[model samples]
Target: MPESWNYLMDMDGVLVHEEHPIPGASEFVAELTGNDIKFLVLTNNSIYTPRDLRARLARTGLDMPETAIWTSALATAKFLDSQRPNGSAFVIGEAGLTTALHEIGYVLTDRDPDYVVLGETRTYSFTAITKAIRLVEEGAKFIATNPDATGPSREGSLPATGAVAALIARATGREPYFVGKPNPLMMRSALRALGTHSANTLMIGDRMDTDIRAGLEAGLQTILVLSGISADSTAEMYPFRPTRVINSIADLVGNSAAPF
Candidate 1:
């Protein structure tokens, strides 16, 4: 491992699973902070703000500061601010997405909005979806926080932003620009946030299709962990491969010298 190496880690699978911290995840995070290593916990879930996520993680036994976390909502807001500063949007999501846009000086409105932004939510409102479709048809650009079609829940899989975005696309004949995982834009934004170059940064994730793919495209080395969505056999199905495939974050605990 490089002495100056930094890290970009996926939150759901790499550190926690279904609101519970994975084994050794806390130790691994502590080691990084203790060594003054720069790193960020990235997540495609746009339902919660970093502050909210920090509290959630703390309950799960992973003590992390809000500054150490990044979300697709934040990335989306940053992208929008760069594209059109102080823009307006018709948002369909929770406080996480709304708060991010608000913080970026984006107005949340429905009349002649600049964009129709979609994000993850527990309840998918038909009224909101209908309004989003109509707005897109009215020439408002479409944007989604992530491309994930489904999200995990205690009961089962729930329709996510991608699934809702697909419906809007089918109605308006326009595809949304996704700003989260699998899009190098988000990865680059994260790198910029950390003030680190991709060459000396490592991305740790569980999914090959999104996490690994995004990191690889963003010029960062990638590690695939089997503690989340992807199984050991899952990588073989992908066209590309992660630099390292480990059983879990537990394996990386107390072993900085191990080949990443």
Candidate 2:
């Protein structure tokens, strides 16, 4: 409800569901841009770049610029760059993760690299997982983009980065450092990207576990919308709570000029 509050919003449930634009979502985004409100669409899905996501969102009737989008891939790449500039990694992911690392000047190699970067992929290969485990055993630091065990798909749930990371961890006895949501590092990274202070930023998400927890840990106000995974009753089970609960982002649209 702060007048100066900037926003970091989740993408899937807040704006769209199953690649379909949610009702009032387009209006909400327009209101933000029309007022020149600073906000970023944050997501843990690391399979696509900002450009790719922007195009996809457009197809769903939500037009957003690439600069207003942030992904786990970008966060992971930034984290790695900070840890070791020009580092090499054995990456297991698609263009999103690979392109991020490449743009950051990281070499993708399998020959005893500095890290084993794991990320979301539609088709996770057993061969790649094997190589990742072997690399971890060879002393390469293990890092995963996010801790999401299951990803939504038309065919039901599919194994995500966290699930694969668990398999690698069990094999090599090395726990991966998750670089995405639920880790305050990702939130802080997004804040840095938006040039916003945590105290003056609002983290809006539907999931209480990842989004709300990440925002709380990063010292930002949190909003849990019922349009996604979390419900009103679900918040009671968590020790921490969102600062506000809304039916959807549409609620924020009409009040864009006013304090949330």
Candidate 3:
């Protein structure tokens, strides 16, 4: 195995910001390939398939192989598969969440669902929330893809997957099975895919509450990069701290040297 440290990365801030690539982000990713660093893209976004993500990255010249990317959707699917219980789920997110659950063998449903899965559902209504609550009361498991309070938007920000989950929980008086960062489930899946010892790996992301927390949960070193959402001011007052803080991935590794 390569003695160079392995890296687990979160998308969005750590990589491309929205549709456009962050400055030097493409070259930064290329450096990973150049160094045989054994890095994997582990994103909390439950939106795209591995293939889709790979293609998206390719547009920016990252060209990550399908196997190197693991989204929260895939992790959730794997988690459901491990349980091996057959049940239908009522999902509140878009095509990504639904496609992921179906790919994972979860039977997505609206009538008499075995579980009510919630995410960033823009079309949510009181009726849908009521039905989901009723299903939960009927002894169905309640799952949330992630508890992100807000999602990044060009207009500033909007409600994240967690906010929708909170609505369902409040209406039903029950909690949700959150499956994203800070939950440990997603981190475990990432480590398994990378085939690396957790202790030797570094988790790099822009969020302190989720990404860094998940790294700590998975027993890996953590680094915070300011290229995306996290701010230096927040880190100074954060309850949890990363092992290192840098301006961007460009600072540590460039297209110049082998992985350290």
Clashing pairs in 3: none
What residue pairs are clashing in model 2? Answer: none
Give the Cα error of residue 148 in candidate 3, in Å. 0.4
Global local distance difference test of model 1: 0.93
Off by over 4 Å in 3: 255-260
lDDT of 3 by residue, 1-260 (tens): 23567888988888787877777777777777877778888877776778888888888767778888887777777777777556688877776677878876788888877778776555667787788888998888898888888877778877777887787788778999888898888988888888888867888888898998999888888889998878999888777789888888777655223233
Off by over 4 Å in 2: 257-259
**Candidate 1 wrongly placed segments (more than 4 Å):** none
Q: Compared with the true structure, what per-residue lDDT tens digits does model 2 show for residues 198-256?
A: 97898999999999999999999888999999999999999888998999988887786
**lDDT per residue (tens digit) for residues 1-260 in model 1:** 57657899999999998888899999999988897888999999999999999999999989889998999999999999999999999999999999999999999999999999999999989999999999999999999999999998899999999999999999999999999999999999999999999988989999999999999999999999999999988999988999999999989877643445
Q: What is candidate 1's CA lDDT for residue 23?
A: 93
Clashing pairs in 1: none
Comparison by lDDT, 1 against 3, better one: 1
